[model samples]
Target: MTPDLFGRHRAVLPDWLALYYEDPLEITHGEGRHVWDAAGNKYLDFFGGILTTMTAHALPEVAKAVGEQAGRILHSSTLYLNRPMVELAERVACLSGIPDARVFFTTSGTEANDTALLLATAYRRSNTILAMRNSYHGRSFSAVGVTGNRGWSPTSLSPLQTLYVHGGVRTRGPYAHLGDREFTDACVDDLKDLLGHTRAPAALIAEPVQGVGGFTSPPDGLYAAFREVLHERGILWIADEVQTGWGRTGEHFWGWQAHGQNGPPDIVTFAKGIGNGMSVGGVVARAEIMNCLDANSISTFGGTQVTMAAGLANLAYLLEHDLQGNARRVGGLLLERLRSVAARVPHVREVRGRGLMIGVELTRPGTDEAAPEAASAVLEEARAGGLLIGKGGGHDTSALRIAPPMSLTVAEAEEGAAILERALRSV
Candidate 1:
């Protein structure tokens, strides 16, 4: 069964669309944190389809909202009044810390990011963009233009001129040996020097935590420090919160909050968790920036009634259950448990990340060499033991990504940890 479907998938889908495992499993359905393949084998889903399943599978609230909205109407153009869309936008605007915030909905993170770039470029009247090293925004031409990760970025031909910045990752770089404060100062100095040599960029877009960069992050307050400098230069700061928004980081509702002393970013882009499994994404910015464009604009499929309903329901559920608090409490324990296990594995080089978005990097014993093969072996072993996870890195694809639903139970976390321990040992 798996072989037949896999063949069909390869024949029809784009070759670049990746599938996991040597023999990929087709997920038939899911409930809670578990999913079953076509063969009826259940596995604990840790990656949550690249962290898109923000809440849980088959959540009653989301299903009911989607069903009821579908029965009424699936879509209505932006020319008409969309109650659900307006209501969801209101809720998000309030949640976003930006002053006098305004929201524009889109169908996916890629489109949301594209819209952000359009606004930033138009407002600043410049095409130059500042992007962090080992960062990924999206796959669209404009978004890809600013991405600094060579593995994910495919082309140099772009509408925007991009300048790469440092300090996204704290453990690996020329300044890796410096103390936290010194490292922050050095990166800020580098930014100042770069700005001196180049034109003023439209905005500096960055992911608070680099998801595809193996969950690497800089020291806290580094961005805030950078913010002070960018503000002096009349540049906009954009926070790419697709992966770190809606309380996934445990310590803060948004990843940008870790560096919030300088106030909110000029623009905030979000997607992944807001609609749970539904297709929803949006950009939030201060009224000045969001209203900068002089021309008419609309998203053909964005803010559709069905997706808006899902977003409203999902937001209410997430807040009602205090999933953010749950993430902090449970994630703290899970991180400790995983670190304990990693301590015994000779090939495990690092265990990092906050909240449920954890990463385990694999390397050759006694060296900093990325052991991509060892990561693959661990992934296969974990899947064979009925656990599903994810893998990513800067370019080598050598880190295990463990991001389960925000509502993960303690028992389930322990179960997954035990399986991961066995898998790492086997590898």
Candidate 2:
């Protein structure tokens, strides 16, 4: 018997494996901050493809680079040196600000984080890793193990000795204990106690802005204290900037910059917008940490000609247009508008985040429990009204995370916020 043209057994696709069904409406094409589905309906793209399309879709320069490079050479083993690969590595290293910093490219953010973890373990000669609870590193086996979320399964190596700290959620009780000086002291003391009790850890990895952890930024002096403790104890710090890199935050090129100088991690992993949705991720390290990798360790598809070309064009596009400044201006406007909505809406628990990476947190209409469902309702209604928004889950309720292209404008920001306001009201 012959199979259907599209495929046989659509049931297998739906039921065979794990799924994240809450994803947004299907998108066919996008330009700037606007996208359309197969039905030709348009929607404002505030989600920016989960913070990967900071430069937007079908960017002419990036497209041209990809096409031109594909016309010439699309496949090349790392055994042979390539022009685009070499130049991209040099450019990334130069922009990253660590003199002598090296770039090891990968196919996705998880691979980059995995590579960073490997180097950290080898450098420290230790298996224990300290990660912040509520932190999201990635979904690879090792990366998932380091990730603080419990719903995500344990890695193949379950006994890897991953230590987690109170990333913003205390296991003991309410987070009200985290607001004051005494609470901060207690958190720090808890961290110190953990470090004292555990074996030496290979690395401490975190997101400068906790992405999946409800878009929360750390407390004042919190990152500084963590850095002091980690450095004092010889634990390597890894900043997983997969969702926060490439000028989305508006303050600086990377989200760690939002934390000021005190948030410099020993190693930084970047993906998402580094190539504006192109499949490219890289690990940049301080000279000391990067030097630990053996020379023969390399992946075949880590840096491809087409991907490198696209990355080069995207980086050039970012610098040429001063998109970072645009993000700051428009992001600030979006924040103000969202804050205004929060003021009027009874369910908004908090309006937190910076620049384009903003979150509209919701609580029960009159209760204290996280309105995770309300947030979902808001997202569903917004989509019905021709706007695209994304949702984040974890500890508290849920948040509608808005991270549009850096090219998004103040006018667009206001319009998107207005649509969100309508969605919230309907919900």
Candidate 3:
């Protein structure tokens, strides 16, 4: 059955739509932090469907809310009033640190980011955008224009003039040898130099943690320093928090808080966890910026009733249970354990990231060359050992990404870690 489905998928879906594993397993169902394949083998889910199953698999609160809302109504075009949408928007606006925040819902992170780009360009009246090196925004034409990673970026054609900047990756760049303070200063200097060469960019879009860039991130407060400079030039700071938002970083409820010395970002885009797997994404900005567009704009299915209900219930559960704290505690243990294991593995290049968003980069022993084969081996081995993880990196796709559900327990972490340890050693 799985083979038949795989053949059908390949026949219908685009070839570029990649799937994990040489022989992919059909995930039949999930509960808590675990999922079962069509063959009835259970695997501890570490990647959480690319960090989408944020709270847990089949969370009761979210499921109940979705069911109830679906019974009443599934969707209504943005032309009409929607109670769930308004309620969710209010909660999100209050949570967003931006002053006079306004929320505009979208169906995906790509659309949310596209909306942000639209706002920034329209408000600033500039099509130039500054993006960080080794960063990814989304797959849309506008979002891909600003993406710096070559692997994820399929084409060079873009609507916006994008300038790639330094300081996204802390380890493998020209300033890798410098201390955090020195590194931050050098990147700022580079930014100033870049600005001198180009038209005033409308905004700078960056991820607090580069998601598809193998969870890489710049030093804390690095953006704060950049903000001081960009603010002087009237350049907006857009935080792409699709993967790092909603307290996933543990220390802060939002990833931008790591660089919040000057205050919240001018615009923020979010998705990939808020709805606990439902298709919910949105942009939050000050009213002045959000309403800058003169022409009418609306997403027909953006803030639908069912998705909003799921988001509300999921968010309430996440806050009430303090899953962020859970992520911190369990993720800390997981990180420490993985680091301990990686210390003895020569192929393991680096172990980095915060909270549940951890990455283990693999390279050829004693060399900087990425070992994508080793990463593939580890992925397959881990899956065989009843663990499901993910892989991502700059160009070689050689990093193992471990972002389990935020509600991960210590025991589950330990179990996954042990399986991963065997996989690493096997590779």
Candidate of highest lDDT: 3
Candidates in order, TM-scores: namely: 0.99, 0.91, 0.99
- Flag the better candidate by TM-score, 1 or 2: 1
Q: Show the lowest summed lDDT stretch of 10 residues, model 2.
A: 1-10
Over 4 Å off, model 3 = none
| Model 1 regions lying over 4 Å from their true place | none
Comparing 1 and 2 on lDDT, the stronger one = 1
lDDT order, best first, reads 3, 1, 2
Candidate 3, after superposition: displacement of residue 316 in Å?
0.2
Question: By the TM-score metric, which is better: model 2 or model 3?
Answer: 3
* Model 1, span 334-368: residue lDDT tens: 99999999999999989999999999999999998
lDDT of 2 by residue, 148-240 (tens): 765454544753579888745422234554555665677778889998888889888888787877677665556567778888878887878
Clashing pairs in 3: none
Model 1 residue 339 CA deviation in Å: 0.7
lDDT of 3 by residue, 107-165 (tens): 99999999999999999999999999999889999999999999999999999999999
At residue 113, candidate 1 shows an lDDT of: 90
lDDT of 1: 0.92
What CA RMSD would you report for each candidate? Answer: 0.8, 3.3, 0.7
